[model samples]
Target chain A: MEKGKIIELYRKMLEIRLFEEKVFELYGQNIVPGTIHLYIGEEAIAAGVCSNLRKDDYIVSTHRGHGHCIAKGARLDMTMAEILGKKTGYCRGKGGSMHIADFSVGMLGATAVVGAGIPIATGAGLSIKLRGTDQVVACFFGDGAANQGTFHEGINLAAVWKLPVVFICENNLYAMGTCQSQVMLIKDIAERATAYGIPGVSVNGNDAIAVYETAEKAIKHARHGNGPSLIECKTYRHKGHSRFDPATYRPKEEVEEWLKKDPIQNLKRQLLEKGYLLNAGMAQIEREVNDIIEKAAQFAIDSPYPPPEEALENVYA
Target chain B: MSMHNGDGKMRVITYRDAIREALLEEMKRDNTVFLLGEDIGRCWEGAFKVTKGLAEEFGDERVRDTPISESAIIGTAVGAAITGMKPIAEIMFGDLTTLAMDQIANQAAKIHYMFGAQAKVPLVIRTPFGGGVNIAAHHSQSLEAWFMHIPGLLVAVPSTAYDAKGLLKTAIQGSNPIIFCEHKLLYPTEGPVPEEDYTIPLGIADIKNEGEDLTIVATMFMVHKALNAARMLKKEGLGIEVVDPRTLVPLDKKTIIDSVKKTGRLVIAAEDCKTAGVTAEIAAMVAEEAIDYLDAPIRRVAEPDTPIPFSPPLEKYVIPDERRIIKTIREII
Candidate 1:
C-alpha cells in the first residue's frame, strides 16, 4: 500500500475508534436513545476491507454497522444524525444506529437479523452479473452468523454462480457473549468456505496492513470474475455486546489480553515505524477528527425530529 | 395495444396460462424482470408448471431455479428488487409461506419505510393458495389475509384468467411490492382474455354477476362459488351482485359500499379461515361507512377455523362452497 493510503486507512480506523468512543460517552450520559453495539475493536477490518471498494460497489452490513457505513464514505454528519434519531440523518432517522444506510455511498442498509444480509449481498452480486456490470459487493457479518442457515445457503449460491462478491467474516470470538467454540466446533470460520468450493483465508484483525492486503486480494479475485472468497479476520470486541451488558460472562484476563491488541493503537504504531507518521502528525490528525466529530454531533442534536404525519409516508413507495 | 381485440378475436385460456403469459410479456418488455423459485426451470418446470418452458424462452438467468431455501429465495429476491431488478419470487405452496414469513413480511415489506423511502423494493411474490385436491394442511391454504395485514404490501387475488394476466403485469411494473395470490383449483379453469397487452389497475373490484336484492363480495376461488350461488338464487326470483376485489390491500371500498347501498344487504365470502380474515375488514368497512344503507345484518361465508385435512370429504366440508355461500346469502336477504 502507498504511504498516503496507509495514512488514510489509519485515519479511517481512528474515525471509527473516536466515533465509537463518543457513542459510549453519550450512552453513559444517557443522551442517546436505544442501545448500541460497539465496533470498537474490529475497526481495522472495516477500514482495511472498505479501502479497496469503489463508491458504486455495494456492501451489506450487520447490526454493528456504523464502522462499515463510515468506511464506505457515508457522511459523518448524517450518520451521527441517524444514531441521534434526527431527521437530517440517513433514512431520515426512521432507522436508528443498526439500520443506517446511504445508498449514494454504496451502503445497502444494515440488518439486525444475523446472517440475513448474506444472501442479500449475494443477490446484489447476481444483479451485477445479470446487468453485465463489473461492480462487486462486500458482505460483512460476525462469526456467529457463520452458523446461521443463510450463511451456508447464501455463500453456496454465490459460489455456484461465481458472483462478484467477497464475504468478510469478522471472527470476534463471541456472538453476543457466547464464545465461538461453545457455539460451533470449528475454530476457523474461514474453513467453512472450503465446503462452498471457494478460496478462504484467516487474518489478524488488529493488523491493519495485513487486513488491507488480504482484502485487496479477495476483492481483486471477485472483480476478475472468480467466485466469492470468505475471509475470516481473527478479532475481538473490546467491550460488551450491547449497552447494559456487564460482560460478567467473560473472564477479566481475556478482556485485558485483547485490549492490549487494540487495532487503532496497532495501526498508529505501524505508521510511526514506517516513518509515514510522527507523533506531531498523529496528534494533529486526532485533533482534526475530534473537531469533525464534534460538529457532526452538534448537527445531529440541532436537527429536528420528523413530524408524525411523515411516518405514514414511504410505506407504499 | 388496445384493451379490446381489434379483430374481435378473444383468447380462451386457463388461469395457469394467463399467469405464464403475464410473466412472459413482462419479462420481454422489461429486461430487469426475472423469476426465481424452486423447480421453475427447464428440468422440473415448476411444481405447478405455471413456469413451464419459461426458462427455455428467457434463459436460465431470468427464469432461475432455486433450492428449497425459502428465506434465501425471498430475501435474495428482495435484495435484487431494491437494486433495480423487478423480481417475481414464488413460494411453491402458500402454506410454505410461513417458512419465509420473516423475509416476506419483515425484510421486503419494511425496507421501503425503514430506509426512509431512499429505495423501493419492487417485488412480486406469487404463491398458489386455497384448499382443494386433498393436499392436506401443509399444501392447501388461503393465507391472503396474512399478507394483507402487513403494510407496504399490495395483495392481488385474481379469480379469472384475464384478471390474473392483467394484475400480474401491473404488479411486475408497479413500484411497490405485491403478494400475487393464485388459486390452486382455478389454474385449469378457462376464461376469456384479450389478445392484446393491457393491465388491470389494482384496488379495483370487478362485478362478476350484477343483481339487485343483495351485494355479494368474495375473493379468489370464492368469487366464482359466490357467482354460482347468485345464479342459483336467480332461479328463485332473487337477484345478487358478485364483486371480486382484484387487490385486497388497496381494496376498492367505493365499489363494495355502492353495491351494498343499491342492494341494502351485503354478504362477504372468502376461502380463508373465518376468524379475523378479509371478510372481517370489509364487513367493518361497510358497517362504518355504509351502515345507513343496510336493511339487514351483514353475513360472512368462510371456511371454518380449522386446518385442511387429508381426507377428501373432510377437506371439501371445510372449504366455503356454493351451498355455504347461498345459505349465508339467503339468511341475509
Candidate 2:
C-alpha cells in the first residue's frame, strides 16, 4: 500500500476508536439516550472494506454500525447529532444510532433487525446491475446474522442473480451472549458461501492491512460482475454487546487474549515498525482525533432536539 | 375488444390483463421499472398469469424470476427502490406476505420515515387475495387490513379492470411503497378500460352507482358484490348507493362520510374476516365522523372469523357474497 493510503487507514481507525470512547463517556453522563452497540474492537473490517469503495458505492450496516458510517465518510458532527437525537443529525433526529444513513455517501443506512440488511444490500446490487452502474455494495453483518434465514435467502439471491455485493461477516465469536460453538457446526463462516457457488475467504480482522487486501479482491470481483463473495473477518469486540451489558458470560482469559490484538493498536504498531509514523506523529494524530470527537459531542449537546410535531412528518412520501 | 361510448373508445379487458397492461405500460414509460418474484418470469409466467409474456418482451433481467423467498423478494425491492430502480415484487399469494412481514412492515414501510426522509421506497408488492377458487387457507386470504394498519404502506384493492389498470399505473408512478391486492375471482372478470393512458390516484373512492336510500361501501371483489346487490335492491324500489374505497390506507373518508350523510344509512361489505377487518375500520370511521347521519344500526357483510376452507360449501358459507351483502343492506335499511 502507498504511504498516503496507509496513513489514511490509520487515521480512520483512530477516529472510530476515539469517537466510540467519547460515546461511551457520554452514555455514562446520561447525555445519550437509549442503548448503543459500539464498534470498539472491530474497526479494521469497516475501514478496510469501505476504503475500497467509492463514494457512489453502497454499504449496508448492522446495529453496531458507527465504524462503518465513519469509514464511509459520515461526518462526526452529523453522526453525533443523530445519536444525540438532534435535528442536525444525518437522519434529522428520526434515525438514531442503529438507523443512521447518509445517502449522499451511499451509506444506505443500517437495519436493527439482524440479517435484514443482507438482502437489502443485495437489492442495491441488483439496482446497480439493472442500471448498468459499476457501483458495488458492501454488506456488513455479525457472526450471529450468518445463522439467520436471510443470510441464506439473501446471499442465494445475489449469487444466482450475479449482483454486485461483497458480504463481509465480522465474526466477533459471539452473537449477543451465545458463542459461535453453540450455534453452527462449521468452523469458518466463509464456508457457507460455497453453498451459493461464490468465492469465500477468511482473514484476520485485527490486521487492517490484511482486511484491506482481502476486501480489495472481493470488491474487485463484485465490481467486475463476477457476483457476490463472502469474506469473514475474524475479530472480537472490546466492549459488551450494548452499553448495559457486563459480558460476564465471556471467559476472562478469552477476553484478555483477544484484547491484546486490538485492531487500532495493531495498525499503530505496524505503522511504527514501518517507520511510517513516529511517536510524535502518532501523538499529534491522537490529539487531532480527540479534538474532532470532543467538538462532535459538544455540537450534539448544544444542538436542539427536533420538535415533537416533527414526528408526524415523513410518515408517507 | 373495444366499444365506442360517450367517453371515447373503451377497451374491454380482463382484470388480469388490465394489471399486466399497467405493468407493461409503466415498464415502457420508465426504464427504471422492473419486476422480481417467484415464477413471475417466462415459462411459469405467473401463478395467475398476470405477468405472462412480460419476460419475453422486457428480457430476463427486467422480468426476473426469484426463488420462493418472500422476505428477500420484498427486501430486495425495498433496497432497489431506495437506491434508484422501481421494483414491482409479486408475493404470489397474499397469505405468504406473513413470511415477508418484517421486510414489508418493518423495513420498506418504515425506511422513509425512520431514515428522516432521506430516501423513498417507490416499490410495489402485488399479490392475490380473497377466497372464491377454494385454494385453502395457505393460498387464499384477504390480508389488506394487515397492511392498512401499517402507517407508511399504501394498500390498493382494485375490483374492476379499469380500476386495476388505472390504480396500478398510479402505484407504479408513485414514490411510496404500495401493497396492491388482487382477487383470484376478479382476474377472469372483464370490464371496460380505456386504451389511452390514465391513472386513478389512491385514496379516492368511486361511486359505482348513485342512490339515496343507503350507502354500501366495499373493497376488491366485495365492490362487485355490492354493485350486484345494489342493482337487485334498486328493482325492489330501495335505492342503494355502492361506494368503493380503492385504497384502504389513504381511505376516502370524505366520500364515504358524504354518502352516509346523504343516505342516512351505511353498510360495509369486505371479503376479509369480520373482526377488525377493513369493514371495521370504515364502520368506525363513519360511526366516529358521521354518527348523527345514521338512521339505523351500521351493518358489516364480511367473511366469518375463520381460515378460508377448501371445501366449496364451507368456503361459500364463510365468504360474503351478493346475497349476504343484500341481506346486510336490508337489515340496515
Index of the highest-lDDT prediction: 2
Q: By how many angstroms RMSD does model 2 differ from the true structure?
A: 1.7
Tens-digit lDDT string for candidate 1 (A1-317)? 99999999999999998888888887887767897999999999999999999999999999999999999999989998888888898998788888888899889999988988988898888888889888989999999899998898889888988999999999999899789879898888899989999999999998999999999999999999997999999999888899868888888998899999999999898889999999999999999999999888888878998887888888898
Worst 10 residues of 2 chain A by lDDT: A1-10
TM-score for each of the candidates: 0.98, 0.98
Give the total clashing residue pairs for model 2.
0
- Candidate 1: where are CA atoms >4 Å away? B1-8
* lDDT (C-alpha) at residue B94 in model 1: 94
Best by TM-score: 2
Clashes of each: 0, 0
lDDT of 2 at A190: 99
Candidate 1: interface RMSD in Å?
A: 0.9
